[model samples]
Target: MEQYKGRAIVQKIAAGRIWFYTKEEQSVKRYRVEDTEKEWKRYEAARDEAVRELNGLREKAVRELGEINAAIFEAHALMLEDRDYSDSVKNIIETQGVNAEYAVAATGDNFARMFSGMEDEYFRAKAADVQDISERVIGILSGRRKRKKMGKEPVIVVAEDLAPSETVQMDKSKVLGFVTRQGSSQSHTAILARTMNLPALIGVPVREEWDGKMAVLDGVNGLLYVDPDEETLENMRKLQKEEQERIRLLTEYKDQETVTKSGRRVRLCANVGSVSDVAGALQNGAEGIGLFRSEYLFLEADHCPTEEEQFQTYRLAVEMMAGKPVVIRTIDIGADKRAPYMEGEPFHLEQETNPAMGLRGIRLSLEKEELFKTQLRAILRAGAYGEVSILYPLITSVEEFKRAKALLKEVEEELADFGIPCGKVRQGVMIETPAAAVLSDLLAAEAEFFSIGTNDLSQYTMAVDRENPRTEEYFDSHHPALLRLIEYTVKNARAAGIPVGICGDLGSDESLTEFFVKVGVDELSVPPSRVLPLREKIRNID
Candidate 1:
């Protein structure tokens, strides 16, 4: 085998192995397998092993990556534990009773034929994962595939599109990068790649059977090649080394305050949804939890959380911050995030072609007073434990703000009457809707603070349905019009003597940090991993 270099991205080195991908050509390939009974048993055993291994990974991911990442791991586990696929394979084996190899061969052949006729590329790729899994299982059962001792030399792996199991099964120590023909940004494989921090690229075509061949994977550009010239490889290696060096330098000051060259200082906080993320944020050097999503209290449960449950959760988050501010948004649920317990409320069963624009956020809370009241009571009860503030979502009108504030006041008074210790809770509004942005001055008069939720604000201002692919191009958060809305809201907040911050994808974007600062954003809350990098970027901003 000839040795060639691929653009290498060093993912986390764990368990003495590395995992990555190399780019390869996009061509249909055929694998012939014979149908047999022994093959079916082998497939079953392999499936069992994969399921067990994936479960262990899921548990680890929950502890390390937290609940959102844990959900991703669970999704992969379910895909492997697909009941329909397993049952179909079982029925075929029982009737045919063929040899193991033949059974494996027939299963692949049949599924390949069926999938080849499908229109959706995602479904078509499913056949490849199934075929690969069956082959790996059969090889292990038949004693054809052996565990090879991979050397220390790194290699960029190239493939059409790899299965989750295939990616996870490799000896990660030798894998330098990953390039695939297909993968969405949110695909399981892509998520794994990101979490692992491997420089990788997907959804690009590779050429020819180049396995064990000298190749180069340019992850940043999504390119791969075989037998590249020396100059090309050397340039890529230099770039890679420079990036690592810069990262090392950034690590030294990760936990320090980010101050500009002229000593203009700004606070960096984290936006988190669950308690599990609290430790990670603090460890990553976040000053505090800026936007604590309170929606998790209402999601993934049979019913609304009790006041004490929310209090405990909020208290834990506040205490973890160690005197840092925790701005918790009240339950921001609607048609898209419907809770099982709120099925009888208006818009509970309401269908919308564009749920993003439908009755949601503060509207749901406003229309359903009891539902809103329950969450208000919880936030109030939690306030005595630490410094906490309430953020209301989707406030398009002054009346919604009035009603929500009035209800919160009533809940606090009722709690006081019941001898429950409650303290002052500051209130704010999330300026996400276009209507809300237009009326920022009015809302700022009553709302104590303002937070521009650019995710929804961009969608509303652009009038683009984010979920619809046809309008995806129109969903630009950087559009001049959206920025004007942000400017409008920020200006209003400043004029009203209320603080404003940005807690969205826009905040984490290092390129936009200076722009956000220029716009007079007081605080920038982002994901934990981005805090340091953004701090580094902001420190240089004029």
Candidate 2:
């Protein structure tokens, strides 16, 4: 028996034979080209073909996964059209008089290295994206592009690493789980695994000899057992059966109300990143849309989205909810989620040593008044479609909250003056900072409701970087000080006659569900997949 440990992305158990995933390797070699223009034309043709392939993949992804996942391919397509990237490829081909394939390979390497060297984890993970697209174009140029194939029976896939495009193209039904030698939690592969609810592990050394061998993947304990002993195999099978039973039972709570044994009812909502997530949320039996992360609009684009674009997107989500309350948090940009255009134009966000604590969230919104007003107007316009509420993120002081509300009011009047129809939006504040939690009493009196962003609150309170693996031990979410802050915020909200909810990752913690319910938490918003499981926990609570 051999035991290995790796980080788990999805907490599940699977037992299957190992199937080593292998791809046709293409080695690009530099060769002198007689006609530089001809070589550039060949590269352009291959790039266009790659874009077409990506468009097809995007459509397929939308049918299988939701639009949120499909958006990855959209970004890849945009990358193909990027002027800087194309210029680099063209310049390399024309200057060096090299084959198109060699130029493309070099450009991809340079860009991937640049992204890998970034300090931000989010940007660092983009290295894989560059490699994926570059390899895709090269494959097209070399006539070596091929889709991965697996046998009919399910098996655990072992690989060095997986690109987002490759992961999406695989036969999902035949895949029991995945084990990779290299990947990050922020990688698209990890995100896809979590979305598909497949047991996945990264950073495990894989051997070619292990192919066709029986293995057990325990994602919950972050262990992979290859050629395990009989006793260990039996225990794994038993655990797998129990997990299946738990999932089967969770489905029974889909339509049931999220109420405690003592008859306390709490509104269970789903936090969504984009309009595409609304369908998944409803499918998971979410009663409302909570913490609609609106920043994705800015993150996914090269330029800031227009007011109409934002309005149409918000309107679709609101209409899809069919009158269920939709709490759309305004765009929270800056820091790790920066766009090139935001750094340059009307919103000049200078580079910061410590971006997380720097000008971001509500602070950035208030500083860029026109940008903030554009979003406010869209939210108000979308409100006319259904029940919509506005939630502000990273508000640290009463004055910040007041200034935001005042701006919103100005936009409302602007719309009314034009005789444009708009719906009333409930203004709320997210208690993400320690300062915000301490001043929740005063803010609650002015705001309509409160949502505690425990993710940032814990980070700020413990003075730890949640993204840093070195600080993982110190980034305690259940510390008494953090709990006290939450309790205090809830108490103040109650005093102000307003409802308080938790929308951060902590909201999905089963162990803390009881604590939240006992403390008069009015709502708990989490990912769509967590809604039913959380509802079951809430019902079992006394």
Tell me, what's the RMSD of every candidate? 11.3, 7.4
Give Cα distance to truth, residue 448, candidate 2, Å. 0.8
Cα lDDT of all candidates, in order? 0.66, 0.84
Please estimate how well model 2 matches the true structure, expressed as its whole-model Cα lDDT: 0.84
Residue lDDT tens for model 2, 376-433: 9999999999999999999988989899999999999999999989999999999999
**Which 10-residue span in candidate 2 carries the lowest summed lDDT?**
338-347
Name the top TM-score candidate: 2
Q: Candidate 1 residues 391-499, lDDT tens each?
A: 8998889998888899999999899899988668889998888898999999999989888888777767787754343565566657999889989999999999998
TM-score of candidate 2 against the unseen true structure: 0.71
Number of backbone-clashing residue pairs for each candidate, in the order shown: 32, 0
**Residue 316: error of model 1 in Å?**
1.0
